[model samples]
Target: MTAQGAFEVKLEPQQDTDAPAGRMVIRKKYRGDLVGVGIGQMISKRTAGGTAAYSAVEEFSGSVAGKQGSFTLIHSGFMSADRQTLDIYVLPGSGTDELVSISGTLEIIQKEGTHSYIFHYQL
Candidate 1:
């Protein structure tokens, strides 16, 4: 089944080091067809070309279609200097409890300060 939803996220930057990359943790509350809360950690690096690259992992807990449990999603993508592209998907074998056997790709859209998602998955 496919799940669609909108969410708002708050990001908090963690302690900084001498490295060129910035690290942060994310908290997300979701509404609409999917209801849940998730926490994630992200590391962002700025390339010499002025583009950004990011990697993150998020664990979501709640219910999907009334099935309750938790799962983890892994993300890896980069933003171009002129455009951005992202890849967010469930990590293999990462689903737990009632969420076992879950597999999916989550498409995120952000515009004008609003963030939404279209999740394609099977459980």
Candidate 2:
């Protein structure tokens, strides 16, 4: 089955370094077909030439399409001088409870200053 949802997230700075890179914690509250919260940590940096990169790991505790459980999502993204891209996916064997067999990819979309998620998955 496919589960779909939308979420709003907040990013809070957690650590900083003189190397021009730092880390932050992320919190998310989701709605739609999936309901719950997500928490994660992210590390980000910018290159001397103005490119940015980030990696993060997030655990989502919620119910998807009515199945209650939790899973971890890994993210790797970068914004070059002229382009940007992101990849988010469920970590293998990271599911628990009702989501024990979950596997999927999540697409984050931003338009007109709004954000949403497209979660494509299976159990």
Candidate 3:
């Protein structure tokens, strides 16, 4: 199944933790076909060639297409000089309630300051 929605995100800078050069608390509000609030933490580092990498683990609780459940999302991303790679997926066995066994990937689209998502998954 597939779902499409818009999400609002808030990033709060955290104190210099032992993690990396950058740390933040991530908060998200998802709407449309999927509705939920997600909270997580992110650590990012600057790499060579003006590139960067970041990783985060977020837990989202809500209803997807009318089925209620919660799941975890793991993110891995890297930026190159001319391109980027992002891997955002639902962690295996992380689903709960009606979403148990859910596996999928999420793609984010940002344009003009608004953020949207395409979720492809199997339940």
Candidate 4:
């Protein structure tokens, strides 16, 4: 099963640099024997060479295979200098779906200064 989500991201200035800090809120819906909706937040800061690092926390609310459970995710990832690539690690999490707890990578492209990130999950 594949999950699809739309995210709204906001960037704010932090005292550290000329580049802004970022926050992303995502709402996702997945289709399967058990359907679900998830909301996640990512907090990011700019690093050297126009790159950025982020810590993400996510919460899921729904039932899977008639079993209702929730989980929290903590992950870290870095964005490339050109903002064209993002590498992420899904770290460990308490959840029924162990497959979700895996490493992932993302590719980001900027259009008019707004970034579009595409994710690739690795188990």
Candidate 4: worst-modelled 10 consecutive residues by lDDT: 1-10
Global lDDT of each model? 0.89, 0.90, 0.94, 0.52
**lDDT tens string, model 4, 1-123?**
222233334433335455477666756554443246657777788866677788777665565444565555455766684554334433445555544443444344457745444445434
Tens-place lDDT per residue, model 1, 31-66, is: 876799999999999878788899999998887777
- Per-candidate TM equals 0.92, 0.92, 0.94, 0.45
Sliding window of 10 residues with minimal summed lDDT for model 2? 14-23
By TM-score, who's the top model here?
3
**Candidate 1 regions off by >4 Å?**
none
Tens-digit lDDT string for candidate 2 (1-123):
566667888999975656567799999999987799999999998878989999999999989888899999999999987899999999999999999999999999888877788889989
lDDT score at residue 75, model 4, on the 0-100 scale:
56
Q: Which candidate, 1 or 4, would have the higher lDDT against the true structure?
A: 1
Best by lDDT: 3
Residue 65, candidate 3: C-alpha displacement in angstroms: 0.6
Choose 3 or 4, whichever is better by TM-score. 3
lDDT, candidate 2, equals: 0.90
The C-alpha stretches of model 3 lying farther than 4 A from their native spots are 17-19
Instruction: Mark the regions of model 2 whose C-alpha exceeds 4 Å error after superposition.
Output: 18-20
Clashes of each: 0, 0, 0, 0
